[model samples]
Target: MTTTKPRPTGSSGSADDADATYEHHLTADEQKWIDKKKYAWIFSIVPAAIPLIIWGVAEWMKAIDAPVFFAHASWFLGPIAVFILIPIGDFVLGRDGENAPEEFVPQLEETKYYRIVSYLYFPVMLASLILCCWQWKYGGMEWYDKLGLAWSMGMTSGIGIVAAHELGHKKTGFERWLAKIVLAVPAYGHFYVEHNKGHHVKVATPEDPVSSRMGENAYTYLLRSIPRQIPRAWNVEKTRLARSKKGQFNLDNDVWNAWLITIVLWVALVIGFGIGILPYMVIQAVIGIALLEFVNYLEHYGLLRQKLEDGRYERCSPEHSWNSDNLTTNIFLYQLQRHSDHHANPTRRYQSLRSDVFAPELPAGYATMIAAAAMPPVWFAIMDRRLMQYYNYDIERANLHPSKAAKLRKKWNRVAAKQQQTVKAG
Candidate 1:
């Protein structure tokens, strides 16, 4: 058997040699090159805030009675640009595919800039929601325009989940509180409870509602995940409270705190904007939550960790989730597509998460894939084949939903027969 080599401590080796020995994967030269790069680009990620600005612009354009194209089209800007243009841009601009050097890793992780960005998202998200409400209550517009305002605002609200996701993973009191504040916008505070304690524990298995199985369409998955998530979150929080000897409805139950926040916000908005604002609030919450679940579907579609004889599943690895390193998309999403690394090390800060070469790659950014998932046929055509490839064409190895297994088996047989015919003809 091969023995593992000892890693050098900072003192044991020459400066160059120490750098080489420290990283498990990178070469000495690669380490040196990456360490020399400046951390300034981390600040450039601020431009990812543009969608919030665009939402404001969309509302302002309508308020001013701008040209029909400018006014009507403004609502579509966030969705179209994020889903369509950014994916095309990823194709054209391509990926850098660089992971920071181990020597510089500590520096990157220790920086306050990353935390500041997460904090900053809270205000921007709050501002977007306020703007939407103000326009709905005061600004005169058609019902369709109001709907457009909700839809545009909903896109940003969905992104608040991202902020909440990052902050939810933190252990600090302030970060956790910040997560609840952002989550209240979409009325999805339960995610903070479920995602951390529930999804992370059962991801990639049939037990996980958040993890989509083969042949389950996005709509079906959303229908399942959204309802299941709340109960799962409640159970998780209930269990925690029991272990700690705390009451479930008490402030110690973080879910209860977040739920209270959500309810208060909803009541305040309803009181201020009248019963008419109720539908807008509901619609935006549904859209935001649906967008999040759709993302959950894309992240771990058809992947599974094998259950052991003892009943525990195999430890999560990089291969369990799909990854993408599209430069612009990664920046926009706060490197969330470095999902493999995130699952493998849940507490790692988003800025410090690295792309693992072994993880299965997504063909496009999550935004683009989510757009495609809206059409069942297009989603199946793209993802089914990738699922097949991931499992080496073995249907049995894929985590297929029970109801859809027979249908998937028939489809697999047809594809196999077609391939056989091609071979025989050749």
Candidate 2:
């Protein structure tokens, strides 16, 4: 691993200061952990295990004609495990101690763990899809139950959403192909085109559907994002074809062709499972989209980049994204909360990602944030003040835009107005 010396935290001369602060380099023990590929494989298992086990147990319950309560309750367990328990474990149990040993930072260029994690994508996804098919076959679940499971299980973790995130950053043909396959499972294949081609380039700006604006609630964002993203994906693919002088129907390399493949898979599922299963498929897609939006809410909750004098947004840095060091959650989601580093270097594998202790931390893990987002006043109250403090530092070293500064002031004003209105009503 290439160890780039740590850069300073401030806007001006902090890079030099940051390098000076660190005297000791990586110890022998730290090097061993950094060098191994097995750690990635082991961590991948943490997220996949619970869902797979739930599917197996539910299947068994069906075989035995188990009581309805046991079988029905078991269905919700997998979603709870992924969204609730794992996030809580991450926030409460994963800690960086004061006495933790210093380690040499791994080289960012190495792709060791990235390769292994990418390969596991297919098997884990196939397993989840098979489980969904099984549930359709014998569980005799209603449309809503199957839909909920498909959305929460097959789409959220099965391969559609998470693996798409992994493949969206990769450059190789096989890596891109794998990403498309995962999207097919959720019938969200357009994400491969829009997310990779559009969102990354336009993130945090008005042009990106997935990027939430300041003061936008998650529910409001869902209303806009889902409808916007689908057509955006198609337009992006068409633009790419026009630029390359390729015919619109070019199947060999066109992203629309990939979407066609996803449609075929969707049709096959409907035909085999009866057209009644279509609603379940739609519900699962909705769930997957909900999970994705929730993740968007956390990625840059109250953050925005400044426009420079050159009429361009400042280049994204570690400071541009939120960071969380909750180890269990990091392990479970494949280091997703170590988001600052990922944005700084998009293609870096999760195993090699590091936490910037100087970066702002999320109050809780992603799951906690999801629950908190449901209550807007409470969530805004907790986060708004912290956002002000983050940007209100010494003028020579502040990391915020003028618009954001104005937004913060306006947010406080709105809070005061609401309080005054409450007092009058009371």
Candidate 3:
């Protein structure tokens, strides 16, 4: 059921309008895509905005002389809102599968308004981080309160990585640089390099650190991803610098230069806010980057690209990535769940990224999937069968965890044999 939206303002014509060469009236579904993403992009800031919400709630609780748990729980609200509430919204609101009409796509891509919406993330994120640092040290809050705040701030930076991911994909220098800067807060500056240079190229292959294999838990993937990503990122930049006759240690290297930003920011925060904030910084960074990698783990979990006759992996297609239509998560992650389209047209802005029906689908949005990924048994129960179904129950087609491969093959063999026998008995 496609609801007809008013065509985006400032448009000369829309799909709703009848044109000279057109044969018939356009249905509401076929109309020019309304720029719902215009305002939805702002929702990504909710994690960063957690402190403001906390302040308002805290003041109200003080006025009412509410229990101490109110203050503690207020800080905890960030996690609840992000993981619990937002996912609820995803289910209730249903899917956002809209795409800009072919005729409208060029104009949609050219629109600068869309670009500006994403750029707003930086200041809001910076303010949230600094304010949280001050409050953690001097706000007269309990130790538990500080931990909640730090974790909440970690969620902010964690989600901010998604913002950086959006900006990083743009061809412009300023946006790319901003991506590096945003990542500095989480000490994941290497993501900008490795993601663009390394992961995208080898995505859904046996080799990609960012892509999770069948039967691999998110914890194992994170353990593998966090350490490997740095050297991977460094190696990418090192090769680039070598081509230009530059030293790896110099500011010209994107890897080191980005790390320099992290070092400077951390040192300044430590000096300004006292060394107690150091542990908070670590707490936040770990949580933040862990959240980022968790997204990575689920995005292409158990999907694989078949190798071609030449022994090169086939070009990545919509089939290689998992896609979701969970509306709230889509808006929160800047349509990242419509990942197949982004990979198909890497430079396409989020506003213009289309949803492909052919892509592999996730059973639910990020929050649900992230939770499942944490517990390997639950994840395997839900995803492994679905993955095998996607490949016609063929284990050979999967990018599998080395340790789990033999067991998985034997298990599936039995399942297939039983199914065949059942058919014969019938």
Candidate 4:
């Protein structure tokens, strides 16, 4: 079991109080390490290395008339490497101030290494797409192999999701454009507009479909979020165009064009590779979408802000978002586990993201959480209690009600019933 040491609460004279309670219950040394920019280089290396190796293997496989298994697998590797592995690795491997005697709070403001790492995302995405096409043409990969390729592409697109998330927070036009381009890779360009314009503005409130209400299961969230997000994306773009006095057909702001690009790309693949490639692409897309939803589930799982008497939700703070300080997963996924910081200060670079020791820590990294989400009863039994403890067992304050609780109970029971039925059938 992962143990997070609690820090002292309250403000101090220091810029970042090592003694202050963090959302994740980090120690003083962990706080100091997070404040420093020393590990930025490490982020750059892993993302770059994974794609370089994948592309090289893909080319070699093509030459040898072998199936591009690893190349296809590389797609999933990138997301797993970035989102699941990195943060978890960091939490487990990172040195706390207590363990490392040399640790000190650095005076440095930012690291150039982080900026370089941010730039690496573009090339990595491009290389993954190119390798997918190469494998399709030369390697003559089979259907299963193509499915792997699709999954890899989906994984590559998941990185694009990370990039979209990062750039969406920036104020500059260049940063925003980079973010849109990243979103385009996933054919999720609308996410750039919707997430910034809609989700963030309406987050943790009923208006935001992506925000999971207390007692909602992952399966329910997937059903609701996916369909809602697509229309929300369209509505957001339509609203933007309306404000600018432009029509939906206007190429400059048309979301349909972005989606068209995705369709055209798939059509080209089908034409070049045959009808089988279409299923491959669709499956790849599903994997990417699944990854996105899973992250969404992680972001605000079982957390809700209280509605004030004035009919407004409380201001989002570090406590509103779930945080994971796992060292490996943090570095790989670009500090996404430092979610509370991201919600509190959206524009801050991933390198500068800080964890709140006071916030609840996920029982495991996202990979494990995804698996756990599959078993609703077990997931609810485990996470429900943890959430209750985090919020001091006040279900009402956490926006949990008897009806929602009952629904969760029924969902879990159904899951058990189905499993029992499966066992009997087997």
Candidate with best lDDT = 3
Candidate 1 residue-wise lDDT, 180-206, digit = tens? 988998899989989999999999899
Residue 294 of model 4, lDDT score: 77
lDDT of model 4 at residue 53? 60
Tens-digit lDDT string for candidate 4 (123-222): 6776666567666567666665556566657766775677667877878776676676666656676777677777777776666788776777788889
**Ordering by TM-score:** 3, 1, 2, 4
Write the candidate numbers in order of decreasing lDDT. Answer: 3, 1, 2, 4
Which one is best on TM-score?
A: 3
Q: Give the per-residue Cα lDDT of candidate 1 at 271.
A: 84
Local accuracy by lDDT, each model:
0.77, 0.64, 0.83, 0.64
Residue 195's C-alpha lDDT in candidate 2?
A: 71
TM-score of each model, paired residue for residue: 0.86, 0.80, 0.91, 0.74
TM-score, candidate number 1: 0.86
For model 1, the run of ten residues with the poorest summed lDDT: 3-12
Q: Report the lDDT tens digits of candidate 2 across residue range 1-426.
A: 334345635323343454464445655665565443335346665444444667677779889999977877776676777667777777677653211222323343454655666567667766665567667666678765665566556434542466567766778888778777777766677777777777777665655667665566778877877788878877777677878897766774446767887898778877776776676667666666677678876677656656779989756656656767776666666677877777766776666566776567777777777777778777767666665456542222233233455665556666656766888999
Q: lDDT by residue for model 3 over 1-426, one digit each (tens)? A: 233332221112333332224334456766734766677776766666776677678779889999977767888777787789889999999888777765577887788877877887788888888888888788888888888888888888888898899999889999999998899999988888899889999999988989999888888888887788889989988889899898888798888988999899999999999998999889888988888888899899888888888999976777888889888998888888988888877888887887877688899998789888878899989999888878767788888999989999999878777877988999
Clashes of 4: 29
Q: How many pairs of residues collide in model 2?
A: 6
TM-score of 4: 0.74
